[model samples]
Target chain A: MDERVLLTGAEGRVGRAVLGGIGDAYEWRLFDRDPPAEEHDHEFVVADVTDDEAVRDAMADVDVVVHLAGDPRPEAPWNSVLTNNIDGTQTVYEAAVETGVETVVFASSNHAVGHYETERKPDLYRTDDDYRLDGTELPRPSNLYGVSKAAGETLGRYYHDEHDLSVACVRIGNLTKGHPPIDYERGQAMWLSYRDCAHLFERCIEADYGYEIVYGISDNDRKYYSLERAKDVLGYDPQDNSAEYTMAGEPKSDV
Target chain B: MDERVLLTGAEGRVGRAVLGGIGDAYEWRLFDRDPPAEEHDHEFVVADVTDDEAVRDAMADVDVVVHLAGDPRPEAPWNSVLTNNIDGTQTVYEAAVETGVETVVFASSNHAVGHYETERKPDLYRTDDDYRLDGTELPRPSNLYGVSKAAGETLGRYYHDEHDLSVACVRIGNLTKGHPPIDYERGQAMWLSYRDCAHLFERCIEADYGYEIVYGISDNDRKYYSLERAKDVLGYDPQDNSAEYTMAGEPKSDV
Candidate 1:
């Protein structure tokens, strides 16, 4: 598709992942609070997501926005999360609607439903356990950061209903680079390989929907989050599995 | 009970309703942006809900908080709702935890699930429909204000799980003083009398719950929201019914 996509927090890990995979796929308008260390293919706008005027300016002709700009700390204080994550997300959504941006792919986190893991613990993360949390479950944020992400998801829902904007919130899991966290049960269950991450977001941009929420994780045998919604709705075909990366963090070549 | 209840937005409708019914029951620390027109019952603190320092100061020694301070307008802009509703709520929750406040009774609205009314409209409002929306259903906010209320509910959930702060989010319906709305099918189905409003908050203070959401409408026959959770969990015994009032909204003398 020849869409003019605005990637907020372009310097962030997720933004970079998308860029590395599909930088030439769309006309990119990269936005971040700080300028990139090395620039390249797309037009970049260095501005805080909370700055409505700057955000609105960048959103002028955007078709889709992959909004990943926020204070991504699980232990973030109320002030930081309120300002950077919650307020900033609201600004992005409002500006997107104002500038007539078609779709917004919000980067929601697993922390939005983190408390579920707290209760279930070892059983939930184990390879044998089959219990799964689809997007249908109510939000039970573990912290202020999670609360802000949930708020962002809610905002997307609101904007979609109120303004007819298409929104897809991706509740991203343990997104470590190259390999999943070594020998961590919880990490293994919720791991999202870099390629899968890029492909999931690509589906977000290409998919047609009103308001949707799908878990962003690779196919894993020890998973608690169901990837059925993502596959069925977004046609997200994730190739890499956390099981491929062994307990010692080495990639297993053969069956 | 002999609790020191700090009622924020004390001069507002919900606050006034609570005070009108149970003002003398507690040691009241009434805080609001505007001072009451003529006050005589409790110690009042005049400050905006957005004023964190003032809110924190007023929260000291408070047992429970009935946080109703927010831009209650359904058509509220992003800026107003963002500041007054969302951020203000976060401050209240954070301060409640900081000051060792026992519970927070958040005044969430029926608008949090208003979209359910959109398609099922006219028919859903009928007595024969039998379709009810219990508190268990996910929020489907119809407006920005509703979105903020949903966010507040989510905040309460987060605070409850992470900090162990007891919370009850009352998804209040049409709260009309004295009687129910006449001739309006939707209004009659979700009417909340002033007496019930006061009693609900009273239960929020008296009863115990980890985290919950209860519809705050009275025991109306033509109700769309289920009062099962409220009655069972919070000991909410509402005495009034919208059916008691005539279509003209006048109370029948004989009945």
Candidate 2:
């Protein structure tokens, strides 16, 4: 798609992943508190998402937004999450509405429903176990950071309902470059490879919806997050499966 | 209950209603931006809910908090609702969590599910119709104000799940002093009287719940909001009925 897209938190991992995968696909306006590490062809705006004027300015002529800016700490204090994640998200949404932007692809996390993992452990993580969490479950955040993410998702819902903005909240699983977290079964079960992350977000940018939430994970055989909605709605076809890679993150070439 | 409770928005209509109905039932610390219009026996603190230090200080040793501070206008813009209602509620919740408080009684509004009314309209407002919203359905906010209240409820859910704090969100209906809105069938269907409003909140403070949502309208014959959850969970047995009052709000002594 050649629509003008605004990618917030361009310096972060998720933002960089989107840029690395499809940076040239769209006319880009990258916004972040810090500049990117390497030079890029897209226009960059060095401003916090909480800065209303700068955000509104950067939002001009943007059609879609991939919002990933926030405190990414699971143990972050209430104050930090409240201001940086919750309020910053609100600013992004309000500015997006003001600028007549069409869609916002929010970076929600697995932590929004992390309690399910704690509640249904060992058996739930087993390879044969089939209990799955679709995107429709009520948010059960495991920490204050998770709470902030839940709040952001709810904010997207509100903005969509009240302003008629298309919002796609991606409850992303464990994302790592090249492979899953080494020797961690839980991580492998929810592992989302970098290419899969990029593809999922690309689907989010291209998808047409009112307000929707979908899991952002690869086609892993042991995954507990159901990607049916993502496939049905956004036509997301993830490429890599964590099962093909060993716990040490090496590809099973013999298979 | 004789526990020391902190009542934010002590100067508002809901606060005044609670104070009028149950003034001597509990020890209270009243907080508001403006001092009460008249004198009172309870200790009062003048501060905005957004002021973090002041809110935290007011929360000391408080057993329960009745948070009512917000911009109440249904047509309120994003900035006012986001700051005054959403952020303010977050501050109250964070302070409650920090101060080791047991519970928070949030004052949500009927607007949280206002779309049902818009959709059902005259048929639903009829005295014979029995369609009801039982607080189990997903929030369908009709305005930005409603969106703010929904955000507050979600925040409560997160705080409850993460911090082990008990929270009760009361989706209050049309609250009138003596009777329902004049000559308005919709208002009559969702009216919450002063005494009933106070008793509902009293139940909110004393009841045991992990995270719950209950309708706050009195037991009206034409009601569309179900009170079963309130009765079963919080022991809310409202005494007043809007059907017992005339369009002019006078008591129907000879029904």
Candidate 3:
């Protein structure tokens, strides 16, 4: 509610989703490398996450940090991921610890464990497949970008254990704006609705977990990521399901 | 056994262990930041692992790369780990892929999953306790150094999946020269004898695996890390056990 939260990568898609749904929930400090397109009620700080002094300054009075800043491309080069994702994440964690920030809700991606889908593909995406990755599994990254995300998760674990920071890594899925991707079974299976994303992050800010990894997908019938940890730990009750929509990305009721 | 092996960090402890025992087994190309104090048969190249061109050059005509180069300190700073460990590992993986290297035996650390011992401490170190970390579990790093190792493991996973380079991460325990650690239950529990260390790495080079995380410890009776994966996959048969040593670290037979 009244806790001052720092949202890095505030110009990204996930940032927008979080803000659009829960814009007025918390007193927010929006941090991004790019300047805001339009003005807002929240204090927008234009600075890169890699800037240690800037990040520490921004976290002066913040209670929580929703760290979403990084190179989001799955095919990003090693240097880009190392600098933006891995180094930037370490900077955030260090800053949080120094400034006595209570919690950090890291925006890890499905790509962190993307290689798990290599052997089990179309079948795993279907509703009939009961196999699930519930965040307890080791990261089997498929790319350099995924490696960086997994690195961020490991950094979170370190900060939590050493510094007593309450850290939660949300392995976010495909987050489209209005609905899930059309005819993409994998996307549909791991779809995270805008509202659900916001609510899950809200729970992250509000919850009291020491260190946790939870999938950030909605309650979908055709899902490979189990949401039990998220539900139990963060009290996240997602409203949308990808199965409720038609194969063409339209709501079944609308069709 | 005559594979042209590139042993990174050839001047380090693990390198010494490998070279001491199995030095005659392979045609070796030793790569290290520090020049060797004494050298004879092997072609020694003194270069930092972070140096991309040097690493790539070192990989030329190399069949197997035992990549042990990095910041070896468990309490190393973030920058040190980032540059020497994480970035250096990426460089090795990239070079291996480019040079058509067959396998990379990564030197991961027990520190990568050190936090697992937080709840179950002294008890977990005992022979009576059946608790174990089997390498399939997610990394729960306790320090920046450990985080870097975990990051390296993720990088290996990525290289194996995307580039089809065989990778085996050896989560090495506390490797001592001749005997188990003295008066330290935790260290003794996961002690890795020098000969066993060399033999285990030899197995890593010989055996084939797509992507694996195996504990690199001797056959200790009071072990927390399970050696089943190593035994099954890499045919690692360690002969040393800490239980054979006295509490003061002397050999029971000699005493």
Candidate 4:
């Protein structure tokens, strides 16, 4: 096998974008709870990530897993997050350990630290507050969905801590089409361009960190995140920025 | 009321040390699965932390909780660690949120970061590598028991981030008395003197930090952890060190 990689949630928007970018880089084994419309890469495995047997089977002959299979709704209930996100992540990690997978790129979200926006609002986005959300800051999720994402990040931490699995948690910011929201201030400040997202995660797949959390955003002028840590640790270099589209963007009045 | 605190696991080793130190500082409502042998200075409630109703009933009038109720054995079975430690901790945090408690001083353990020792051993203690185990370092627990402690810390994080409950996680080192074994270098380096343990926890109740992870070791020449974070964040001032007693005077040699 030429660096076989398992891509869970291969049909989702983020997953598809990642696959579209790096699908040819490795021998891909696509996985999703529901089947995709078109064939993905080389192999496809349709199954729920929470199913232990299914995950274990998917890990066979695979060296790495881009685990993106979970309920992504911001308003998901605790029961949904518990089963789909938390338990599913635990199962994936245990199986990765059991199968001797060397690395995993967990799909952690900005929502993992979403409440920071309320505290870091308007000022960092539009007004002048030189503060930024670093990966080192403690997670403050705004909803149950964010809680699930935080749990996934912790699972990566546990797997790396216990099994020494190289894991990277990308606290992805808002991702927009073609480019970031051209005139939206907060979105532009937080937008992770598609090219940047794929390439940053590509760094995650290749970097050697015991366990790390890095933001996924382009080099945006309005970004309220410190990209220095990510650049120093993961060697991430984002080419695009939301600033390319607009100078005076709309205000985010969510308090 | 001057200040009221709920001390969980009032019978455990760490809990007893904390109780002995601050028994007079705050009006305590002590909780444990097994009641104490003698009368206490304040109210004592015999209740399991896993029981939400019991925890809630005992949480009333509590300003802060020194949560030391989970299974502490480093070699405990997975089932026990899961039910008693992980689930029980979730229950405690939920109950705290339900009762609107202000802060939680969680007793996290060194084993949460013990695997780092095995990987860099001999050098860490045997040789003078002096690779300090800073609180910022990602945990690499050596055992399932360590995983449980990590889970407890995450529970504290979730409660703090989501519900605005104040939390402080203390990654306690090896705690023993009379002296740390000189022959057992790991023990000596990681030893937490009794008074230091008590006083360090006393600071947990006294100082303020929204969410923090701090090393629970006194200022010792042989220490492998940095106490700067604890001192800066929690105002912790430890008063004892194992070096005060010669290692030859200690009974145990096993680390």
Candidate 5:
């Protein structure tokens, strides 16, 4: 728990969730394109992920990198995603290997396999459906952004195979604070509570794996992404479930 | 086969194979970064695939595009692959969508899933070992070049899903002219004959598929990469088999 973890994109939603839940768990070096509003405990570095020198400098003495920095937009332009997501991820991997970083927990998105939802839409999102997409399936991206995420995952695979870098790509689901998404069946099925998100990423850092691709969702009842890999490989024991929340995003009574 | 086909990277090896075999079949618009040394039977245009305007211009009135343009080297650097392979592919997809091109036969390499051979080594290259990697398997790239190819495949997936354009990725094996590779079991296992390579690309242009990833190897007996998808989907009837050749790369005699 005392490993000096370099958390890129430290100001983003996923970054905030990881820090908010497990801020005290690790010796942190936070990196982001933007400066922190107010500094507190961890060392903060304001630099773009695509900046090779800055990323290498940030990786100095860092054991693990929770690489979450990138263009996160689903509809992001090709130029933006290519530069920020694909290129930036490459920079991180190159830096990590050069500076002797042990592991990289890449924040891959559900969009990497987003087209899997195309054929099996409303039914796949329902609790009655038995179909699921584990992490082993080929990427069928639905957008340029998704393509970028898939590219990032492939980059991780390459780095691991070539340089023996321990890499784990968390194909993260719909992470929402407090409750699941309101009235959205797909969102509900793929919902990841903030606490579970933090826990999943925590396991990713702590786990000893050569390379892995795992779904980063809570134990949702109406789910298509299998959490078996995450549970078995990363020892990720998620405590939250989307089924605990009503369709209206309200907490259901335990009665 | 009289469709106005735009052939990118017309100067490369695969382009030569296709044109050499099926030169007179299609009304061709040849495109390459380098100008043809001699006069071609078809119209040729010199332009980079990364140039969006140039690609679109080349796509004008094109019914099919045999996109073979990129850094072909397996050891190509990150910047080269990023720009030539990934960015160039996006540009092709964009141009194809914009200019109403019907089909794209992408020259994807076996390197896209090269790491699959890592654990299974020389055994998987033998005829007795039935371990096969069908098209449905996820990418396990071993190098940066492989990563870029996988990224291109993902980009094709995105374009097919979003724009309804037909895309077929031919994960081509080691394409050698006349005979199998000399004393390389891995190469012999996945060896693609020049004639078979041409026919495969022809099938890619002719047959109908929404989006597909097919092994472009010949009917090699010592193969781990399956050609069933290609045969079933694209009606790819390959003629040559590497098993007909000796380990020293000589064609076996029929007693």
Candidate 6:
């Protein structure tokens, strides 16, 4: 597999996590709607995912794509979500196919299956509720943004099935640095440490699949989401856990 | 509950089956993208599913919506499927949510779960595979059009869970009038009799559920999909069977 990758939305929080670790490992070509403050190791193209021409230009000679460019707000409105997420994702997928890119690691969110939370929340974080969220479960997105994310995952599937391209959808959880927020049980259960985030995405680039949906978070003891698929498919082995930061009943640190 | 319903795509082949018998009972506000040649008892709106304002206007005071709009061709291109199936569906669902409609009997197709056929296809049609396609199984759509339909189902789920809007997705089988098509064993086993189509939709109007996914075909002796859920949930008691038209081992009719 070629190490030459074009990472869109490379200036965002998840983007930084990826670049901070894998900067020297691969031949990087980053694209962002906004240019980052600090310079990168390789070429950085400032462009919008909605702009097809710009995406096409940035996509030239790229072996793989990590497409994360779009609106990420949970409560994003219809019009904004339409252009930023749905239309923009279509543009990217089309561009990837047009450019003959091998693989795409799409950043799908937990909200793609968020409605499960209404019934499986607090207990999923506690020592009870043996119930777990598997990748096989049908998506029940919570908001328009979640709908848009789900749309992205479906786009990946279409491209893969129709065009023979490989794709992986990472249903990412709450990402935090050093420690998870205090009293936020849900976030703690789903926390993806910065180190683990980078490694999980690295697996996205390395692994092989026709089309897959895997959870991207540290292997927390409180999690209801099964990491078996990720481990078996992507060779993922998460390191960090939210249990280290919390005391007996609550969090010890106040961030 | 009111026996009256507003059904879109009421002139198509599948629509004809659902409309032929139910026409005698419900006070329907029938609609079709294409204007039908014959006169009807209920109001018909000859407009596109993308037309949000027109749909919402028609949805006023209606208790249920049996939406079957959009291009149903399984091999449609990306743009065609994206706009007609995905975008049109989003518009309709948005309108349904806006109008405070109680239930939506969405015409989801068997192709939405067609990927499972890879392991058990022509053989499964001849003899039961001990495996049956259920509503709860993960969506493994075989084509882009199927992917679009799955997306529509997910959208229904979101609306139902988030806004208390009830939705029922019917993964319809090979719908034919008199008998199954020639050289099409898959169609024969999965044939949905015309009378049963009307019967199933009528059940949709009567059944009570927050969210459901049920097969929309007759109870055939030569079948793969289990009808337990449809029977239990929608009270779907199909009157016609494919075996009645065709004799054992000897060929008869291809409707």
DockQ of each: 0.75, 0.43, 0.85, 0.26, 0.86, 0.54
**Candidate 3 Cα errors over 4 Å, as ranges:** none
True contacts kept of each: 0.71, 0.34, 0.95, 0.27, 0.93, 0.54
What is candidate 1's lDDT per residue for A96-134, written digit by digit as tens?
989999999999999999998888899998778989999
Backbone clash pairs for candidate 5 read none
Could you give the candidate ranking by lDDT, starting with the highest?
A: 3, 5, 1, 2, 6, 4
All candidates' lDDT scores? Answer: 0.90, 0.88, 0.93, 0.80, 0.93, 0.83
Residue B175 miss distance in model 4 (angstroms): 2.1
Query: Cα deviation of A138 in candidate 1 (Å)?
Result: 1.6
TM-score of chain B of 6: 0.93
Judge the docking of candidate 4 as incorrect, acceptable, medium or high.
acceptable
Estimate candidate 3's RMSD in Å. Answer: 1.4
Task: Write model 3 residue lDDT over A1-255, tens digit each, in one string.
Answer: 799999999999999999998889999999999999888889999999999999999998999999999999998988999999999999999999999999999999999999999899989998999999999888888788889999999899888988899999999999988899887889999999999999999999998898999999989999999999998989999999988888776789854
User: B1-255, model 6: which lDDT tens digit per residue?
Assistant: 445588888888877887787787777888788898788777888988888888898888888889888788998876787777777878878888898888998888888877777767777787555668878886777787787888888888998999888899999998877666556777777889888888898888888899999988777777788899999888889886666565443445565
TM-score of each: 0.97, 0.91, 0.97, 0.82, 0.98, 0.92
lDDT of 1 by residue, B1-255 (tens): 789999988888888899998998999999888877885578999999888889999998999999999988888876788789998998899889988998999999998888878778899888899999998877889898898999999999989998999999999999999899988988899999999999999998899899999999999988999999999999999988998888777887773
Native-referenced TM-scores of chain A, all candidate models: 0.98, 0.98, 0.98, 0.93, 0.99, 0.94
Off by over 4 Å in 1: A253-255, B253-255
For model 4, how does the per-residue alpha-carbon lDDT over B1-255 read when each residue is reduced to its tens digit? Answer: 368999898988887777776678888899999989877878999988888899999999889989988888999865577668877787888888999899999999988878777667666774356678777765567776777787677667767877889999999987776566567777767778777888888888889789888999867667778888999988888776665656576443445
Q: Residue B27: error of model 4 in Å? A: 3.8
RMSD of each: 1.5, 2.6, 1.4, 5.1, 1.2, 3.2
Candidate 6 has which clashing residue pairs, if any? none
TM-score of chain B of each: 0.98, 0.97, 0.98, 0.93, 0.98, 0.93
